[model samples]
Target: MSEQRADVIGLGMIGGGVAVSLARRGRVPVVYDIRPDAADHLAGVPAPLASPAEVARASDVVLVAVVDADQARTVLSGEQGLLSGARPGLVVVLLSTVAVPVVRELAETCAKAGVELLDCGVTPGDKAAENGLVAILGGAESTVERATPVLADFAKRVVHCGPLGAGMATKIARNVITYGTWRAVHEASTLAEAAGVDPAKLLTVIDAADPEGATLLSWQRMRLAGKPETRAMVPQVERLLDKDLAAAQDLAGRVGVAVPLVDVARKHGKETLEIRVREDA
Candidate 1:
């Protein structure tokens, strides 16, 4: 791993981490962010600074990890975007958890430009990615093969999810479950407290249900444990659930499915959305 092979573009946390990993793997990643200080933060680091367009032009392997599908479009189609800088047979990996429509739209755009657009979202959190143990899903055999070394530089396991956009789809679905489950726990615990059932005891009991419950539940327990230092979420439980519920609802509507429990939790979550995001953000 040296600096010669380091050439990628990133714009998100995952993107930042990937760029750093690629640098460690001998790749000099071209990094940028809309934030004014994005470049200065990484200045002089192995990861070099460049505008989104410049990176896209210089990068043979472009990784888009924007916050949402909208940002993805802006990065690839905006003035001086990826398409302008991309060469033939370029590998454009969409590593964001975005809507299926976003993936398809971006796919069409990349196809028109003759670049191979692969929806390759990854999960496994920051620690896993840092250790190269993240899971990658999407792309075809040849496409996956071509991208394997780059992926391996940041992931321990990579699975091609059949066709294009599969990675994006898988990530969206996974988030819907995870965020929905998080909201469910918050709402349930809130209800329990309102009913005079000490939610503390309930969380303790739930944490023991290993086969059925999950580490997610354990996280909820930690947040709602009544210990002021760790009970940060208690004040804004309603809001956290609200944002995730909205995300889940958005996902459900996209899939043309109805999630009743999710709807109920969201209805309860909205009560806290404004106060929480404002403070947290």
Candidate 2:
């Protein structure tokens, strides 16, 4: 119905979801994927075009959701790739989670073809069809504005992080927080299980004490805010962290459970908490 035509390349979970979401909003995108049957898996999505180039030819904006950097490169530059059919002013929004370097490399390729590239990092792949994804984007402001309407069809919230590779960079950093916290929770669960406590109960206690998990980011928030009062409290917080981590290590030793995360946390207590000791102190 809208004048702006959009297409999708790749029909995997994320891509299929994007197509479905767009269709639900009355913007059934021209779709492409390597597998001939990819469209059958999605409702309201048309069958795949023969190649990425065909999809490009029919689209003003194309969202590429391939699995990795190599596939993305192929989709954009290989024979029958999108660039072969891309018209001037065509915008390609890459939704893959490749490295920052890879994003920049692909952006260069897109630029030479007179196509604009936006590195878009989407989260919670399972929610892609529900129009619940948060699109973390990086590109020139004008390019971002041009693609926002198509992007809005699938993403519930769109954050323009900065230029070029910033979206992928932010995604990588966010993944660190996600997986790092999982590792920390794994260690905690191990300790609790070794000490004859149910891991579920531990989770219950954690949820009850910090329902929103505010404590997880409190230290970083304080450090970032950099108020004099928060800075003054860092040393005390560092001491408390060291003491608690030491106790966890000791408890784990007694229980014969490995607390490697706790060990590392203790080792980097001051650094982790952003506490810098003054020379005079």
Deviation in Å, model 1, residue 24 alpha carbon: 2.6
Winner by TM-score: 2
Query: What lDDT tens digits, residue by residue, belong to model 1 across residues 1-281?
Result: 32223244554557776766665665656666666455344423343444566776666677777777777888888877878777778888877777777778888898898888778777855743373645456667787777777777767677776787677777777788788877776755655565566888778878776646665556445544435444455456666667767876776565555567777756765342222222232
Candidate 2's residue-wise lDDT over 39-85, tens digit each? 99798999999999999999999999999999999999999999999
> Candidate 2: lDDT of 135?
96
- Clash number for every model? 8, 0
lDDT of each: 0.66, 0.92
